[model samples]
Target: MALVPASARTWLWHEHAAVPLTDAPPVVTHLAWPPHSRSRPLAALVRTAARLAAPDTAPTP
Candidate 1:
């Protein structure tokens, strides 16, 4: 995968996602935010790495 810097076109590559390790139904295990977002741009970038890595069949939040 390529490292995308801009937010606008970055999401376009997100049209697809990585596969999951399990076949279980998708679920939200947890959600979190950095302290005032001191590091990353969004929670989805860090918190939902697993979800994003897998197929995007699950409904969007």
Candidate 2:
């Protein structure tokens, strides 16, 4: 498990070449929950897992 500070969310995508990190491309499927909420971290993990599961499908935007 990892902790992602809200401010560093954008940086995570840029620094990690392997992960799908793009605000415009909608890397995550569903992100209705507030980012500061506890569930936001889970959502991030889900997106990360999805990216890792299928790297080819994720666009590098």
Candidate 3:
């Protein structure tokens, strides 16, 4: 009844066995923030998340 990432299956196995939903549509995740915010910590977190999400084209190693 829930959709979870495959990577989390093992950790959640004890709670409930995961059944692959072969026909399920791919999940899309998104992030949002106030356009004019200038919080340094939030900016860093957003940058880190973007880098992790798209590693192949990340500017730095």
Candidate 3, clashing residue pairs?
A: none
Tell me the deviation in Å of residue 47 in model 3. Answer: 1.3
lDDT at 46 for candidate 3? 77
For candidate 3, what is the lDDT? 0.78
**Candidate 2, residue 44: lDDT:** 83
Each candidate structure's TM-score, on Cα atoms with residue i matched to residue i, is 0.23, 0.27, 0.63
lDDT of 3 by residue, 1-61 (tens): 8887888887885769788879978765676889999999998987897777766655553
Residue 49, candidate 1: C-alpha displacement in angstroms: 0.4
Stretches of candidate 2 exceeding 4 Å from the true structure: 1-38, 55-61
**Candidate scoring better on TM-score of 2 and 3:** 3
Model 2 worst lDDT run, 10 consecutive residues: 17-26
Best by lDDT: 3
Better of 1 and 3 by lDDT: 3
Whose TM-score is higher: candidate 1's or candidate 3's? Answer: 3
The order by descending TM-score is 3, 2, 1
Please estimate how well model 1 matches the true structure, expressed as its whole-model Cα lDDT: 0.53
